[model samples]
Target: MKSSDISVEAKGVSKNYSSVKALDDLSLSVQKGEMFGLIGPDGAGKSTLFRILTTLILPDSGVATIEGFDIKRDYKSIRRIIGYMPGRFSLYGDLTVDENLSFFASVFNVKVADNYPLIENIFKDIAPFGSRRASRLSGGMKQKLALSCALIHKPSVLFLDEPTTGVDPVSRREFWQMLERLKTYGITIVVSTSYMDEALLCDRVALIKEGRVLSSDSPRGVIDSYQNTLLAIWGDDMHSLLKELRSYNEVKSVYSFGQEHHIAIDKKLYNHNYIDSLTQKLEERGERNFHIKVIAPTIEDCYMEFSANKEGYE
Candidate 1:
């Protein structure tokens, strides 16, 4: 990609909070109008990176740029060009929905009427409760209102930190739909989430853990990196199945995955007859009503693989 097409850039950015390092030489780029996701568990430096890029906090080392402007010297200009919605609801609880929107617009030196078109699709659902105080709104409604206020200024890039963390399932789905709509307006979006499944929704995602990036690629790309033979096994008694699978000397790892357990075996021990041999062994042990089948790897599976690899290296 050309330099002109980049909306956000970070080069070896790092942050230290006293004895703890929040970010460790992190570097990445977001192209114009792209929906980039930062995926990781809590305390994985997602929030720290977001805070740094949004100019709410400064990094301890390295450098970053927003719209090609230096983060330190050009922060004033960067602030005007980006919209930020923190993980928590930071709006005025005492103020009504209408008041919050109007206040943010005024702060940006713009009128709500001027940017109504940009936010109408998201704000319309909560418009009927315009008189309601922000504190009284539901989790989903508050999210929409916050998003509306963020867009009121017509920012070129938006930063959202765990926007769907506490929302309901339906609301989470709806929130992503709203993001999809926003992408069509030529706005670059950078969002962070702990939900591994949400990674599939982004154009690209960077898996982070303990202040380091484990991997960065499209969802499919990450899964494809799992160059291992995996199988899903389940039985009438999941506990027994898990225990029996773990006893196998060839099994590398076994973890519960919804209705079944995803079992990874050392590639050297795997063969076309491996499944048959496992079934026969289970049958010999009087394990009835069990099934084993090869399966595709998921984002969570890939994450676990990376985590395990890191641990082994250490």
Candidate 2:
């Protein structure tokens, strides 16, 4: 798609829920046919942003436009042009797979036969089990059915809010594959997810936290902005060692990364004093056999740094 063809645009959007600020002057633009991702952890205002963009809720100030239509003023047009799959499984549990799809299609005033070509590849997988109730479907199957229903109306833009959560890794991978294929149909996709790994799958991503946008760019662009050298350290008594490690003057930051701890130090300004001090400190505490070394930063690392930098503003 051309860069000028913006499918989603928001300008200085802000929202509040009584005493809590859900979004703060957040602005973003996404081009048509591009797979854009909104990444953040829980309670980071991701859901609020999705709600506003999908026209489920309105912002307190500023404006959001989808396909050149204002979310509040042109909500009916936007709703007709966009397909939304919510964060939770919202299909009627009492209805069968076919019934659920038929219902959603009817709500959108579209016939399943009209969009069969658009969803056949995915719907075929669930066709044999069409009679089964939605409540009895597995996570992967439920996800596929929901996706099919979302596309039944042939929406120009699709909004998926954490659609892969709770599904197994294999199912998550499959879900992403489906997204890639959708791009070929010229549909813009804006997906909000807490999964760091999923962030890399998008052509471009916006990292959001506490209702504010921290960074926006391609996955590689965001990762490239990470300025710190990260290192993973592991040893026994790690639980107790964490406190002593933080007490070091040379350590800039510390975060848990999978099985090990990602330790940050000012290699430019600080000497091995940080490492030596940590080793010595651990030894004094009877903690032994420690291993520490630098490792390449991941998308998750960039997100941590991005969110940490935002904390200063709060």
TM-score of each: 0.95, 0.92
Q: Rate the local accuracy (lDDT) of all candidates.
A: 0.91, 0.87
lDDT of 1 by residue, 3-66 (tens): 9999999989999999998999999998999999998777889999989998889999989999
lDDT of 1: 0.91
Per-residue alpha-carbon lDDT of model 2 for 1-314, expressed as tens digits?
A: 55369889999999999999999999999998889999987787888888999899989999889988999999999889999999999899999999999999999998999999999988999999999999999999999999999999999999999999899999899889889989999999999888888999999999888888888999999878878767788987677667777876666778887678887666585455555666677789788887877687888888887777767741
Regions more than 4 Å wrong, model 1: 284-286
Model 2 TM-score is: 0.92
Residue pairs clashing, model 1:
none
Q: Pick the candidate with the highest TM-score.
A: 1
